[model samples]
Target chain A: MAVPATRHDHPPSRRAAESARRAAGRSLRLGFLLACAIFFGLPVTWLLLAATKTQTSIFSDHPLSVGSFGNIAQGWSNLLTFNDGELVGWIWNSLYYAGSSVVIAVFLSVPAGYALAKYDFAGRKALLVLTLIGMIIPTAALVLPLYLQMNALGLLGTPASVILPLAFYPFAVYLCYVYCTTSLPDSLLEAARVDGASEATLFFRIVLPLSKPVIGMIFFFSFVHAWTNFFLPFVMLSDDRTFNLQVGLMMLLQSTDAINAEGGFSALPIHQPEAALAALVAVAPVLVAFVFAQRYLTASDVSGAEKG
Target chain B: MTDTETAGRRPARADRQGRRPASGAESTVEPPSKRRRRLAPYFFVAPYALFLVGFGIAPALYGLYTSLFTDSLGAGTEFAPLGNWGEVLTDYRLVDSARNVATYVALWLPSMLMLIFAIALVLHARPGRFAAAMRFVYYIPGAITGSAAALLWLFMVSPQVSPFSPLLDLLGVENATEAVSANTPLILALMGIAIHAGGWILIVYAALAALPRDVLEAAVIDGASSWQVAMRVKLPMVSRYAALILIATFAAGTQVFVEPTVLATGVPGQISSTWSINQLAYYYATQQGDFGKAAALSLALLLVGLVVALLVIYRTKFYRIDRGLS
Candidate 1:
């Protein structure tokens, strides 16, 4: 009875107008969201679907058909058997390089950034300026110089060549600086000092423990940068055994670089399906890290990366 | 009075005060002695600082030195200042590389921002699990490495075995080359880049999240339509975040590499051998063994990168963290 009374309390025309407005807003929102899903989400969907199908089935009349999971297994097998289990070596190398770099950067860059943020030191401003420039400058600029360095030291064929340059993570240092300056409290440090705690004691016991989130963020960022690094490793590491996944991936892509004179492509370097699987392999670590780290990688983390 | 103790040494303040550590004590615990407080920072930073100098500053200076000399076939390293720079600047491959990158930035910057902005706004409007899941999905492609994304998109563009071959054919594209042809509505090269560029979408969504709820409700209560509120209020509020993403994108965009190189496979002469400026430098250094030329080109790119960064630092002023352009 109350609902009926309330329904009639407002004029019918006005109620209808309000309902129309609400409906319009809802549609606008959902429609744009649907477009977003199709735009951003569709390619991945197409990729997964295409991966499940046999290469021949892809172009049949029903290209989007639900193909069997067996195809993925087959693709996996093919990738393994190609060139005497080569991709495994490359994947291992990528993990080693990216992992080692992340460890070094997390340990080193975190402290460097902390020093910049918490301590008033001479040359800090100069270091900060250098970091900013290092970040903005493209990775391409460093590859040539590093190659010469590696060449001059006679370390070109070794993993150390790539590992050394990756350690110079200026961007991660800056990220840590921004995170600390904003989130960390100077009062706590001064209080610790007043309590007669040494700087090392204060840092290890208090500051390092509180800086976990930023460290995680820096680890993942550095990991991704090193993992996807193609130019440096490409220039420095020529041995197949020393190649990271990105360089190996480039090598795989190169096999297909030549186009046919008859207006078509030759057989893909690897089967098309296998290439997708390799791509999946290449990105799985990043995706896993994201799933775990997204808990800590908030908007501020991105802002630090973008605006730091 | 004198600088006697090493900088690494800290003052044993706890022992001097004769104070307990507020807890259990260990005999092995030695108090720190400090002489130079300011120098203590260098201790905190020395590990990474070594990297900064050995890998960063030293190599950069070394690059400049390398750029000044040429090592050619049958000739030892000869001093020829600006020689390599002069050659590479006039090289058509370098010219085309720069042109292609400029064209790509022009195409990529606007569409990328608009796509990301729209998606962010829509997700902002609907605050729910669905939006969150969609954001996660959007970020997945970005996690994929550049070479992998290129391969994935290549499969999509390949007319021989792609699910979207029909749609591509409808667009009159018969093959991967045509699908990515500069004239095509959907450029495959840009598509590879756009997919990898989805990381910014989350940043924008977060910006939108910071919009005050009460402000929006007030706009609605004041007789403003939903459309008007979004257009006027939300748009303006998030424009700063959008601008930050744009400037960063512009700086990164000029260094485009992996996307063009990987996708250029399907297209023959339609794309150049050295499709990107980075790849051109790589080719000069590694393939041609012209380290001087590569270094020269890299320095040039570095100058441009610096200029772009300066534009953002000075022009945008968004770095003033306290104010936040709001």
Candidate 2:
């Protein structure tokens, strides 16, 4: 079957043209891919390199070069001792906020999603619409109302103000809804019901077990959103002690004069290097999480694509 | 028939038997009243309904109410009755912000479409180990915190220490700090966000993947080039996905707060507290303590979001579901 095609093949010019087309296609793909990699990858590389340099060296030396170990050690020390050990406090605050919010968001959203997906009920359509609206309505638009609501309850400057608002994950609910409805067949649930399994038991034992892919996706998404959330925390929490990693970095960037006043050994102010280092610290967890759970997320994308 | 098939058939027979009067052991269960059965679905949806009322519906209604009146930065509330809307329409700052946002949308929407389509095309054309690796790397930044991304861009765009400073110099751009002024900063901010968001457009790419391969093969046989195929056949097929992306991008674009607020450092006096609608609302409520106006601005944004949401849902056929079991 394969050999017959060679005898029937076209003349040299046509074959050459086809080969040229294939080659051009491959080169285009590679060129564009390389360009995109550089476009997205350059900033990250800059951050890594800048984190190693001192403030003076950042400007004076080649921006892309790896600096000496002495400079990196000094940068680390500056990050640690910046604002008299506040960086550590901010890291703790971020972990507490993002970690708790992720747990609560997943907890609330999963069951709610299961309920919506498995049970046919009144207002199910309405709830789905509301959730869609909630997902689309950028959180920034609602920040004012949320802040006012928090202020009325005198919850401003408190962690509850941030965590409570972030916990309301409409998008997670949507994700879980999609996952459960499509992936978890009803016959399995019907069989479990016949075996005298209660709704709660079924959910925990069967539904939750089968939902690992989506749960991981939801957790990663919620964690990243909560972790990187700055506007809400910035507006709600005035106390620097309560600032999350993102807000902490913002404050560090803003405090350029104060860092200069610290009278470091170098001529340059430590703000830029410190800012880069702080940003790296903030994004580190998300990068780690992405590496681990990315296959699941991409799988979800593939499934969604097939569905679409 | 096998025992399992007989067992499955037995349930249908039993169901029919139970329906007949006094014919089976299963008939003893109480038949629920129609009203009670109807109400059960509502009970399942009650939590979300209540949440919508309190968190979603009420605040939005209150915002519409508040926009009608003028509350003088917390001094006192006075009934302005169309006054605030007039001010929103007439105020210079608000007008400038609107114009700025329009310019931003124009610049951002096109760049995002071009870049996302280009990247997605590349990924689709070559589906292998490298494609997977490329997708993961591009998406990693998006998974990071938005604020961190913004902060990262601050260093990247700053002339004093940016690795891209040499590239900027090569482009004959002077003073990286000045390059991020109000007029130019929005584009830079959009580029930062675009870099962060390339991973998301993979959804559209996924949609593109679902387009029949035979269609492309046919196009190729018919002498259509790759570019021609992408533009003519592929794009038209994925119009719905593209529409979804456009609506989503527009809705999210209006809420541009973090990027501008962070980049505000480079451009002083040009970037205001109320650069975007959300920021306007924030300034009114937090800085000025004017809840009423803030509410008004939020309501406006909510309306825009609602329209966009409805458009996406309607266009995407998101509501339609077919259960093969039924």
Global lDDT of each model?
0.68, 0.65
In model 1, what is the error at residue B131, expressed in angstroms? 3.2
DockQ of 2: 0.31
In the range A164-273, model 1's lDDT, one tens digit per residue, is 78877887786666556545545455556667777888779877766666666677778888887877787887787778998886666555431223333435435556
- Check candidate 1 and list the clashing pairs: B9-B33, B10-B32, B10-B33, B10-B34, B11-B33, B11-B34
Candidate 2, B-chain TM = 0.70
Quote the positional error of residue B214 for candidate 1 in Å.
Answer: 11
Candidate 2: Cα lDDT at B284: 69
* RMSD each, Å: 10.3, 7.8
Interface RMSD values for all candidates = 7.4, 6.8
Report the lDDT of model 2 for residue B36: 43
Instruction: For each candidate, report its DockQ versus the true two-chain complex.
Output: 0.32, 0.31
What is the fraction of true interface contacts found in candidate 1? 0.40
Residues B1-326 of candidate 2 have per-residue lDDT tens digits of 33234323422234234343332224455544323433544554455455555556555556667778786656677888777777665656676677666777677767777778778777876666787678766775565444445556656666666777776666565664566762464544456454546545545455555454534655655555678878887776665456556656777677666667645544444467777667777776778776666666666776776787777778766544423111
